[model samples]
Target: LSDRLSRRVGMIVPGLAGMAVMAAVLGAAGWLPDGAALVTLVAAWVLLAIPDGLHRSSASALVVEQSPAPSERGRFMGALGACGALASVLAPVTYGFTAQAAGIGCTFLLSAVSLVLALGCVSRVREASSPATPE
Candidate 1:
């Protein structure tokens, strides 16, 4: 409901929504013919740019949220950072392979599906942790 949560939702949505658009563009531009390596290289670069901005916002959220709870804040932030690191290592390789084998449409579709599922999950988490009275 707030801009903060909206931004997080945007983070996941755009990656799926935008990546689908991008995959279509790459297909139209005939970049797919240029081979998986070249297409993946360029796609990776572009997607990386938008999502990193999203990640930065999430990082800011973590800092802001943790400020009052000085105790355990470091552990909380550290675990969050570590989870991101794990995703970084895994996502590219998985996406690259998916794109290479199934074509860009499937790749985009996969991302979209992932985003939808994540949105649902995050919404639930937010609902659970949120105060009974909305702030």
Candidate 2:
């Protein structure tokens, strides 16, 4: 599903994923009541899963699209993979510590803010990379 979406929408697929992530994190951050929290958490999990799928499909395409040459692609992708691995390792640890200090609701709110910032960065990169047309 994400592969097809990425083929059509390209980088926008990840942008949408970022938005979904932000929404999910925000939803998980005490927006729902006690009885509804479980359902909301489940829905947030689904929302997070969408982005996970979209990212895996879209990131490779982005590597291909952004690399200046085929020879550079391997190095670019390697770096990308390393960064992803680092983030995966670090994020959970950071979230755990943050939750311990500030509580789960605040941690989720912080995650939502981080996603929003990431979306803004993606949008800027997209705009900068897009071709300019004659006036």
Question: Alpha-carbon error at 17 in model 1, in Å?
Answer: 8.0
The 10-residue segment of model 1 with minimum total lDDT is 126-135
Q: Over 4 Å off in model 2, which ranges? A: 1-31, 126-135
**Candidate 2 local lDDT, 1-135, one digit each (tens):** 433343325645465556556555654646667768777776676667666666566656666566776678779889989988999999899989987887777777766777766666555544214432222
Clashing pairs in 2: none
- What does the lDDT come to for candidate 1? 0.55
What TM-scores do the predictions have?
0.51, 0.73
lDDT of 2: 0.64
**Best model number under lDDT:** 2
What is the lDDT of every predicted structure here? Answer: 0.55, 0.64
